[model samples]
Structures are given as structure tokens and as C-alpha cells.
Target: MSDGITKIKEEFDKKVAEIKALMKNPQQDTGLLSNSVDFRDKNLIYSNSDGVFTSSKDKIENYPAKGYPYKRGVKLSFSADGTTELEVEAGGGDDLYGICTDIDEFTGMATVVPITNNFTGYLTFKKNGNGVNPGDKLHFNAQGELEKNGGNDKSVNAIALSKVHKLTEELSIVLASVFGNRALKGN
Candidate 1:
């Protein structure tokens, strides 16, 4: 059964790659033009600067550089001044910046959530005030950790995704969906 699943996955990946290649080079087959139209109608694909179709439309807008493990709901951007390595932005200086979504750390790359989508990640809830839950708003600390509003933290970001529940009263790491503001334009 495992082998069957693996084979199915491999074939699916191969077909997707073929479709991507065909989309990249439309001249390969005029029939592919119609295929692209069909694909675009069904998928919410965003074009990268390089003009290549991405593997998934969900979390990644395009392929991440090697060793970057951003799955879904997170986008990456580079700090212009080089002062900050990775930044999860809540508000862009222009007020176009969205909100916090996920809490995964990649040392060499900057990450952000999409302005118009819902994202989920494992985040630590605040231990203060009986702790946080699915409907609570959150902010990211300087260290890239998520916390509730009302600290030195200025960003009053909130969760857009629903979180799973645990019966224990202790503060625990749980999966959560965060919403609002894009950290960067580039994925």
C-alpha cells in the first residue's frame, strides 16, 4: 500500500512538472495554451519574477531557495538594509502590511503571511490572563515568537485560522491559523 501511494505521488509530481514546463514554454504545443487556460481557471497561480509556474498555489508562491522549509501560508522577503535577517511584518510602513500567520524560523531567509489568505502554524500561547485560544489576536515578538497583545509588543496582530484544543490548563504549543498583513510582496 505504501509503495502504491509513493508511485501515485511520483506520477502526480511528474505530470505537474510537465504542465509547468509546458506553461513556461507555450510554443512547445499550441494545445498547451488551452491547457494553461484550464489550469489558470482552476488554480489561483501567481507568477514569479522569473516567469515560472510554482509547484503549489497554497503556501508557496514559488520555489524557495534550497534549505528553506516554508510550506504553506508563509511568504519570504529580504531586508533591504540587511539589519534584520527574517521579518514577519504586520503593517508595511504604508499601512498595506497585513498580519502574522505562522511561527516557523528560517535563519537565512525572511518570511511573511499573505495579506488575503489564512495560515496555520504551531505557536505558543501567552500564559498571562488565563492564556489565549482560537479567536484571540496575537503579535510577534522581536525574536519571531507569537504572543498576546498588551506587552512591549506593538503589533496587535490576530489569528485568522482556527486552533486545535487541549483539555489541559497548562500553556502549550498548539497549531493556529493567523490572519492579516503581508510581510513582503515576494513569496
Candidate 2:
């Protein structure tokens, strides 16, 4: 009887571990392909990846030092080909890649936008010049801002992890999950 109880406890623990793992990788735990998934705005102002739940102002001084800051941490003065030189071309490609997670309540300025992946979190980045819906799909335009997903362009960099509640406010910031690798393009 004791052995049976131990086995049951072990099985329960294993199932618990599996559920925790699923929550940690919300992006992957689902069977719905990125294309078929329908994202919705759940009004989640900030998640573990977005940093602390403080008023936007309080987060400003904390921004640069934060784990998933929007701006790129390093700049490349040379091309990846060892000694080939390159100039610092300004635009979008150099910054973070997901969606905007937080904006100042009063100023309406965007604050947090995480672009990279981690052992346990999703992220956000800026929007492209055009508008996007919650589940509309997205990718990096040449400038690096989130653009409509490229069907087969080899640059389909990400998928909208959540929907933007456009009726409430224009989606100045969006929450997204980056594609670890390039996925299919639509056109």
C-alpha cells in the first residue's frame, strides 16, 4: 500500500512538472501553428518578461539596466566577415524585435519592449509604419520594425504573441514572440 502511494505521488509530481514547463514556454506548448493561432489582447500590461509592475515613470531609470531592454546592447562597426568594415547605418535593424509591453499612462510614451527569448519568457517590440491586428501576423521590415508577416520572404522574423486592442488606442507598442529561425513567407 505504501509503495502504491509513493508511485501515485511520483506520477502527480511528474504531471505538475509538465504543466509548469508548458506555462514557461507558452509559445511552444500549443499545437496551433503560428499562422492559425488567434491572439487576443488580454490587457496584460506586463508579464515576467516585461519587468516590474510599476507606474511607467518608475520604470524609466530602470530601463537601460533591465534584462530585456528594447535598444540593442551592442553595435557592429564591422561586418561579420572578420575584417570587413561597416558603417553604423541608422534605422530599425539594430534594435530589439518583439512588441511594446508598457507605455507611460500620462505621456503615452512607450517604455518596455522585449525582443529576445530566454529560458522562460516572451517579448515585445515596436510596430511598423502600418497597422496590425492581434492575430494578423508580423515580421521585421527592412527597417527592423514589425511589419506584416512575409509569406515566404525568408525574413518572417516573428509572430504576434498577443492582439493589439486598437479600439482603445493605436498599437504604438505590441507584444510579440520572435521566431528562433526564419519561417515560411506568405508572398
All-Cα superposition RMSD per candidate:
14.5, 16.9
Local accuracy of candidate 1 as per-residue lDDT tens digits, 55-86: 24444322222233222222345455665454
lDDT string, candidate 2, 1-187, tens digits: 9999999999999999988876645376455434343475333335433443222222221121222223221112343456554322112333433333344445433443333432112332354334665565665543434566545544555556555433233234455555433444564
Q: Tell me the lDDT of model 1 at 101.
A: 28
Q: How accurate is candidate 1 locally (lDDT)?
A: 0.43
Candidate 2: segments with Cα more than 4 A from true spot: 1-75, 79-131, 150-154, 165-171
Candidate 2 weakest ten by summed lDDT? 58-67
Model 1 ranges with Cα > 4 A deviation: 1-60, 63-113, 121-130, 160-172, 182-187
How close is every model to the real structure, measured as TM-score?
A: 0.34, 0.34
Candidate whose lDDT is highest: 1
